[model samples]
Target: MESITEEQLIQMVRDFIESESSAPQISVSSSESHIDSDHHHQPSNIDTLEEMIWRETTDVEVEILEKILMYMRNMGSLIIEPKNLKKWVVLRLKMDGYEASLCKTTWVSFPGRAKGNYEFVDVITNGTRVIIDMEFRSQFELARPTQSYTKLIEALPSFFIGTEEKLGNVVTLLCSAAKESLKESGLHIPPWRKATYMLPKWFSENCKKVSFSPNSNSTIEEF
Candidate 1:
């Protein structure tokens, strides 16, 4: 697996947004909510579990969710996605507190071709159920951020049914852990096509993380 520092990942996201600012090729629309009791996955052991995948959302993904909590206090809403194909975040969007990096489901398999099985997955969040769209990836696939997000949003809803509880209700970027695997296997990943323009100075090289403005000075979270 190729090792990538967090900075490289953030640049990929900035580059993605810039590309979309130049032109719009997105064929996206709001998805319908398929909330059915039969479709929802409620676990029998949920009451017994102490540490849950849902709580991991805030702890694992961003380093300073606590500080982000303070910042969100004033704001009524937020929009976030993992950078560089990494994590998924689910927050209460309430009481000025947030939680992310929630895990919905995980699947393990082979790497790519002959397509025998080369696929392992941990679907932390399904955006459709949550009613949002976001994708995270690294600089290598930096070109088509919008396109990728669009596709994930479209496909996630159908699977909402039949999952264990605590796993459902999320759609975060889960590509980080796999970025190295894909590169090591020499898979030809398409550069995210949506981004066409250069990014702002905040994302210039020699950067560590971007402190989200108007928020408590970047908080070392989601830089």
Candidate 2:
């Protein structure tokens, strides 16, 4: 990726902020409608996990998440592929003066895990790193999910923007719950769904950071 000049970055930020300011504010309760209609009947554990997710989110993360949501609402239709969408999001975050990058993580097969690679975005502010997964809830979907597990999945956000530690905690909690849910339904838990396997998709040491530039080709650096 080529580098964008400071002047260009400033102009982009100004335009984005102006457009965002004109848009109507979104209500927090509006998201509740996306949940399953049966959410009211969900078990206590699902409620606990939902509470934990929000409780761990910091103010900075929330602000960034709102920008992301707005961008998706206004400009997402123009982008068709997931990779391009992520790249655009990184550029937008940079315009907002956030240290954001597109990260690609690849892992080799281990004794009990399969080889796989994944891509997502991350932003650093005030010495804290936050992971952003646009496809967060789908990662936990099962072909034949138990009613309980389905309820749990419904409680998750379609996109996640939070600290790495909090994400890890969520993975652990969800994976454990998944195992139990599957067991209750006489189904076997897949290795890919285990916390040990899923965690590396974001935390792997083999991550490559791709920096965006508007004027030139993007550059990749191994982390």
Candidate 3:
């Protein structure tokens, strides 16, 4: 008898599944199907959460992903915790004339009993509790997982409706790499991408300029 290789084992599993319409009875899902008295006896927050959001992936990364919150620090506009958005910024270079997508995610958390998970992201973009809604659309662009960036125009939404009244105007900035970056050895961002700043905050006195680490409390994620 010959031993099966990794590829062969995978193929065998695929063939077995195709031969059988149903999967092995590992555990019943409380999500993808109707609840039965027998299988519904399980306990899991994420299980019920899946039904609440209607999606399998509602995860938000913290160690690095938490940086998305910094955008709120320098904004001059407001959305009053009821909106969500994600935008595409840059693209990774591809032969098909492709680029990685970039964007940000924001929302405020609602006051809830279960870990207070949902409310934080909602107040940020007005999403209901347990949901992580984003305001800037640029974070979703790149499927790659890198960590470095500098100099770009980003949006600043209001926490409360009509925040621009006190915030003045949103603005962009001329930038160097993140504070701990090595680009000083001659940083090379695209000519079209480098910028000084955008207004109405550009004309403000309090908005000071400073170099930040690529990962320094920014809206961009690991990739």
lDDT of 3 at 106: 25
Q: Which lDDT tens digits does candidate 1 get at residues 102-189?
A: 2322222223311111111122233312211132212223322444333433322211111222332121122331233345555555
lDDT of 3: 0.25
- Residue 169's C-alpha lDDT in candidate 2? 84
lDDT of 2 by residue, 23-43 (tens): 333334766646676666343
Question: Which candidate achieves the best TM-score against the true structure?
Answer: 2
- How much is the lDDT of residue 129 in candidate 2? 95
Please, what is the TM-score per model?
0.23, 0.74, 0.18
- Where does candidate 2 clash, by residue pair? 1-217, 1-218, 1-219, 2-213, 2-216, 2-217
**How many clashes does the backbone of model 1 have?**
29
Clashes of 3: 50
Q: What residue runs in model 1 are displaced by over 4 Å at the alpha carbon?
A: 24-96, 106-223
Point out the higher-scoring one by TM-score: 2 or 3.
Answer: 2
Give the per-residue Cα lDDT of candidate 3 at 77.
Answer: 39
CA lDDT scores, all candidates in order = 0.28, 0.72, 0.25
Query: Any idea what lDDT model 2 has?
Result: 0.72
